[model samples]
Target chain A: MLKVENINMSYGDLQVLWDVSFEVNEGEIVVLVGANGAGKSSILKTISGLQKVSSGKIKFDNDDLTIIDPAEIIKKGVVHVPEARRLFNEMTVEENLIMGSLHGEAKEKRNETIKKCYDLFPRLKERQKQAAGTLSGGEQQMVAVARGLMSLPKLLMLDEPSLGLAPVLVQDIFDIIKGIRQQGITVLLVEQNVQTTLKFCDRAYVLENGKITLEGTGKDLLNNEHVREAYLGI
Target chain B: MDLFLQSLVSGLLIGGLYAIIGIGMTLIMGVLKIINLAHGQILMVAMYITWVLWHTWGLDPYLSIFITIPLVFVFAEGLSKYLLHPLIEKDSILPENQVLMTVGIGMVLVELARSIFTSDYRSIQTSYTDKSLYIGNISLSLPLVIAFIIAIILTVGLFYLLAKTDLGRSIRATAQDKFSATLMGISAAKITILTYGLGSALDAAAGSLLLPVYYLYPDVGPLFTVKAFVITILGGLGSTVGAIAGGLVLGIAETFGATYISSGYRDATGLVIFLIVLVFFPGGLKRFTKV
Candidate 1:
């Protein structure tokens, strides 16, 4: 489980996150739904140690994440698949996956994990030798997710995994997220595709202007008047 | 015909050594995204180390490689760790502080060498320094031939490390995308330090290889630093394969220019080629080869 307690984040003089707070229970897919610039990505970044918080704490299974080095954070089973699928563009597809499992147990089981990743994304195996930049948008997203899996993460944080993906590929990505949950890996997802994400997530939180404004079970949020009007557009 | 063949042979041979020098700068540039202005100065320090070993210990310049590489690696590692690495965190107004820091490092190194060595041109005398092997009307300098072989071996060894090894992969990964690499648990700071050290180690190798035939002075670092810079640009910013080609092209071009256009214009010839590449190829040989 992960707990984010009243974290305030800022870049230089401009405050982006104002005492934001949220949590994710074990073995559940938690979705953070918000408009553009609502600080969804900022929350994920602060949790991953890529960005520092001005106040409050981020705890993953009771480990103080604020002081941990960004590189060391991943070793504690918090693998963040960042927004836009920032794969090593010049490296081969397989090389990108190899980069994922570079520390500790993941490194030791590298070969097996790579095999598992290839099985999960057979298209990637076929294009294993090709440069990652040359892959299609959908395939690149798959590579990013598969790369996250290669780290053998107990809790995976996905930041807009479906951004820029086509509608058909978007469905495939959502299916993969469901499958990931079935494997008992907890997921923290930030999404712009609110309707589809709301239907599947165990719980959903509405992030508005850097603060958590609403939280409820998936069904409760689906019928909420404010959620339907702003996000679902019904 | 004979003169052309002779110069061509010598150029290619020396180019092998130049490739090692270029590769070092290229690696540092690729990973750190900063032009290491101190590259040649570090090489100069290594040459001085090699010279000291030869003068005081009677060790062959080639044999001193075992000593010079580790010494230079640690030295450069410390230089970057203590001086350059800290600049990354400083909220300086000028973003070019890291590159400027290298310039300061170079100046200090040159001054240090001058105070101790007194600017006297130093060359090591070995049995093979002046000897050459003949084939019909063309001859090869024995020292150069040996250095060329060593250069080739080092090049091949480096290729293996970059292509097949885990450290090499991490280095290349860091070079391609520092943020993503860190997200994968790679300490980009550690990689930057290691890369600076490794790059200088290669420079040390080139310096040792040059010592038997080349003269060394306190300010000799700038000349090769410029050469490394030209080659890195000529090879396209951070491409490894391009560095080798760039070195060879510059070497052959300089020799050909010396032979045909006049020896005084040899350095100018390389500059001319560099400008032409800048105007035409722009991306260096990597634009053509896609390496």
Candidate 2:
């Protein structure tokens, strides 16, 4: 559904993403894993049209994603649930979800969608009126995911969805990712949590210092000794 | 007793106009998080447009709103795109750079007005400027009363726009956090332009009211700038409702002070509130302390 080819990105003289490339097939969960400053998030940013690439082309659903604005990208049914669960702190969870439908209103089915989101995360429905800032870390992540889904996208790229969560909450988030895949939305996930990401994702890529160092099935990488040592820190 | 009732009624009438002007300050501050020191000068500029529409075309000042509002919106849009957007984009106006730049813009706009229109005060004295209606002991100038009503309508209309629309959601998103807003598919530049246009529209309405009650010059805007700055700080920078309340409070207090105290220091209410907000309610009537 999406393709990125040889994207080079830099901030002034410091290169952040060098000759990075990746792809997301329809309804597939592709995990991009790496250590800090490894350009995994940069790839997601490039795909979402938020970060400028020094050189490359990004094609999504047969459209040039690189040439468009972030709004346009989302309107094209490619929504990005950014890292840090950047829900508008002052807005209610409902409002945050409403913000997701910026391209146009899905008014006729809004109630149904809200119900679907509630079924996915009952905790969120209970606290719908609460300010997003006041939610627990896991609950806020749910709001972020729900908000991203509000766009009714064919693909959702999530950056570090399990970041800063407890072990139980992290497990719960992984389960939700599986549930999202069941709903038929393609996902490109970026994460530093190796074992969970490898277990959760089908096809995975390892990024190291702005380059793709490894690519294979989650099982292959799990059994690979070098991956275990450097990534799983075993 | 009658004089007091009269004063109170008159104070409320002008209070409404102050609310209109103060909302412009709040609207600009909300999305951009900067005081538009040039705001008052923009108001003066709009007032001149109203004057021209009245004097040149024989259109009533109130009747000219249909044109003036959109004109002001486009004018502010151009200014935001060409001037404010670039500075905001470059991240050039940090805490250290903001005051000098905003005040500098204020001065430039004022001088631009002066050079173009000269320092002479202008009055759009339509035939009805001084006509009044007396209901019981309260005598109200028809223009002043109409200005107040229109100002109220503009304020409520703007509040509705800010609170009830998709564009408003994007604006609120941008105002709260730029990065998050972008992540949510909002273009910060577009929101800023829309916000500036809305702010300028409020300023135009305020200027429309000023047409009948006040004489306008390049210098007229500075006094308004002072009042707007004070009102915005008192109300909390981003709260349109706060701006309305703060403006009315300042208006009534100043009106009473001018009558009972020294008229020389009448307008000191705004300055006094500015200092009070700085020293006391620094977070503004509520806590803008970001916590």
Candidate 3:
């Protein structure tokens, strides 16, 4: 479980996130839907300890992650898959996954986890020896997600996993996300594609201009007049 | 033809040592993405440590490697932790503050060596220094041959570290994307410190290997600094494989230039090749290996 309480974040003089709060129970897939520059990514960054929070607490299963280092945050079983699927481009697909298991218990179970990842993405298994940068967008996204899984995370945060993928590939990626939750791993996803994300996620939150504007069950938000008008473009 | 063969052989032997030096610089550049301008000075410092050990304790230059490496590793680690890492967080007018800091560090190292050891040229006298092994009419300097073998072994060891080890994975990950590496539980700060130390240790090995044939003085650092930069650029900014090729190419080019042209043009030869590589193969040997 993860709880983000009234976190305020800024970039130098520019305030990007204002009193944004959200929560995700164990094994739940929570989606944060917002327009471009609506601070969706910023919220994830703040939670992952990549961006410094001006005020607020990010607690995961009673452990304070707000002031901890990103590496330490990860060791606590919180893995963040950043936007654009920032895989180690020059490294082999296998090496990129190996990087995921660089510390703690993940290092011990690296080979096993890698096997599991390969099984999950059989296409990745075929291209294991190839450089990640040489892969197609869909394959690269698969490598990114596989890499995140390699860390044996309790909570996995993904930022726009379907950002640049084709429509068909986006569906495959979403299916993978659903599969991941079925594996009993909690997921916090930020997406610009609202309709699909709301349909799949158990709970959803609407972030508008650095603040949480709406939060409810996925079905409730999906059918809300404001949500349909603003996000679903009904 | 004999002259060509001799020059080529000699160049390759020397290139092995140069490769060791270049690899150190490349590793540093790869992780920190900053040119360690003081690289040569660090080598110089290592050479001085080797010299002192050899002169005072009768330790063989090769034997002193074990001592010099760990010492330089600690020194460089401290330098990175206390000096360089702090500057990374500070806002600067120029983006190249780190590179400029290395220049300043180089100057300080040179001055420190000069103050302590003075400007006198020094060289180690080992029995194998002048001995050579013959293969037909061509001969290989015994010390150089040994140095070359050691260099190759060290390089192979470095490759293993980068490819097979967890630390290596974290380092490569950090080089690719620092933020992402952190998310994977790699402490970028720790990796940077360790990388600086590792790079410095390699430089120490190079300095030790070169001590038998190369003369040492406070100003020796600049020449090497220039050579290491040339190799790093020629090999590709952060590619260890590229650095090795760059080192050999520069080595061969310099030797051939010295033999066919003039000894004075030996250094210029490397510079010329560096320019050619810059203009033609901007990615260095890394463009070839794609690693």
Q: For this target, which candidate reaches the highest DockQ against the unseen true structure? A: 3
lDDT tens string, model 1, B1-291?
A: 999899999889888888999999999999988999999999999999999999998899998888888999999999989999999889999999999999999999999999999999999998779999999989999999998998899889999998888799989999988888888998999999999999999999999999997899988899889999989999999999999999988889988999999999988999999999999988899887689
Tens-digit lDDT track of model 2 for B215-244: 988898888888888777777778877887
Q: Fraction of the real A/B interface contacts present in each candidate?
A: 0.82, 0.61, 0.98
lDDT of 3 by residue, B1-291 (tens): 888999999999999999999999999999999999999999999999999998998799998889999999999999999889998899989988889989999999999999999999999998778999998889999999998998999999999999988888888888888988888888899999999999989999999989998999999998899999999998888888889998998899999999999999999998999899889988787878765
Poorest lDDT segment (10 consecutive residues) of candidate 1 chain B: B281-290
lDDT of 2: 0.83
- Taking the tens digit of each residue's C-alpha lDDT, what string does model 3 give over A54-76? 89999999798888987888788
Provide the TM-score for each candidate, comma-separated. Answer: 0.98, 0.93, 0.98
Name the lDDT of candidate 1: 0.92
TM-score of 1: 0.98
> What's the best-to-worst order under DockQ?
3, 1, 2
DockQ of each: 0.83, 0.66, 0.87
Candidate 3 Cα misplacement greater than 4 A, ranges? none
Task: List residue ranges in candidate 1 displaced over 4 A.
Answer: none
Residue A48 lDDT, candidate 1, scale 0-100:
85
